[model samples]
Target: MISFHFEPSSLSSTEKRDRLLKLSVVSSPILGAYFFSTGDLSSPFACPLREFTGIPCPGCGLTRSLMAIAQGHLSQSLSYHILGVFLFLFLVLALLYFSAELITGHPLKISLSGPLQRHKRLLFPLLGLFLLSYHLARLALLWQSDQLLPAILNSPLGQYF
Candidate 1:
């Protein structure tokens, strides 16, 4: 069995980011295998939040969204998870960044950090709120259309409905 320890305080931010990018490179194929084997927007991987609360958290359809994006179904992917296209792009960017870093002998200057540093505290929470709102809106649409019934019916309060 494999075990892992993540002690970020021990490493410089650049080193930590580089390590994560490297890990992303290694995990792409594994993610691809999962996406292919799962075979649709409904992943076999269950969300604990959804199971317990009868409502999805912000990331419910991410895997399916990424898979759809991989299959060139951009619109469908966005319908599954609004931010998944951006997520896929970030994954691609990380893969390229790590690959380039490996081929070159120097560390690259990180992008996004400069801008993020200015409003790090404010930006992250706002982004989280935006994503949660988007997810709730999507769920509302699904619920109105009766598409989320099966999931709802399986939760603890399913007895009342």
Candidate 2:
């Protein structure tokens, strides 16, 4: 049996800010290369899971999606993987928040410090539903369209997907 714990107290604003900055630094070059690389830009690196299983992972199209966005193809990016857009939005917000924290010396904090803390009751269920729906949609698309997967994987714009 496995047990899981959720403790809001463990969420540290400083750590969040630092992590955001680190991720931005790490993603920059990959994003740049993804944008600049010519066609035939499949990764030299192989996915270990795919190698062992011969099945694509749920995350298979995400890199190509990012590459598409880096290359300024928003429609193709979203088509490759919807979550890539969410990730880009989250990254941009995190970068902005981190930048503000660095400049102001006060990291942004989700102040569940008052009655808002109780709002977790509503927030959790809503978030869960959203994630469930999103994944279901992706799975449906994957099942319905074999071409979709390979199209994303092989697209010249797919270097980022």
Candidate 3:
């Protein structure tokens, strides 16, 4: 059986951030699949960062993109977020991996983390730069279209202010 445990004091800031990032990326595809299977186009979860900061998080458009992909609208998905198709493909691979594990009675030890850990010094910075650039571009587009203020005002937490 699975168990829940917490030890906030044991984790460093970097560890906490890494855990949060992993949770977001890993959970998105699974949750998207669940919503798709259930015919729920709307996600119940909102990005806490976006809600509070009135800014789109790196993963902001993911759910809508996933929804569009589920409906076989590739162009619509790309418009929402360029990474959605990649995430969807990752989800498919994960499902296959899980199924293979079940059939073979042996969990595949696919160590994606090994390479990540090895090159993390270089990889992490590049990833951060890319995310930052993409976020800035997204913000610029919103600003150009005169949607920035509206986005801020319409944000869940912003609505109260």
Score every model by TM-score: 0.67, 0.55, 0.61
Model 1 worst lDDT run, 10 consecutive residues: 1-10
lDDT values of the candidates? Answer: 0.70, 0.61, 0.70
Candidate 1 per-residue C-alpha lDDT over 1-161 given as tens digits, one digit per residue, 9 for 90 to 100: 22223332344567657766786765684378345745555665788888876778889888788778767788998887888887877777677665555455345555344556666679778988999789889889879988688777878777466
Best by lDDT: 1
CA lDDT, candidate 3, residue 19: 48
Model 1 TM-score, all chains together: 0.67
- Measured over all alpha carbons after superposition, the RMSD of each candidate to the real structure, in angstroms, is 8.2, 9.9, 10.2
Best by TM-score: 1
Off by over 4 Å in 1: 1-21, 29-41, 111-122, 146-153, 157-161
lDDT of 2 at 116: 55
Off by over 4 Å in 3: 1-44, 109-121, 153-161
Model 3: how far residue 33 lies from native, Å = 4.2
How close to the true structure is residue 47 of candidate 1, measured as C-alpha lDDT?
Answer: 87
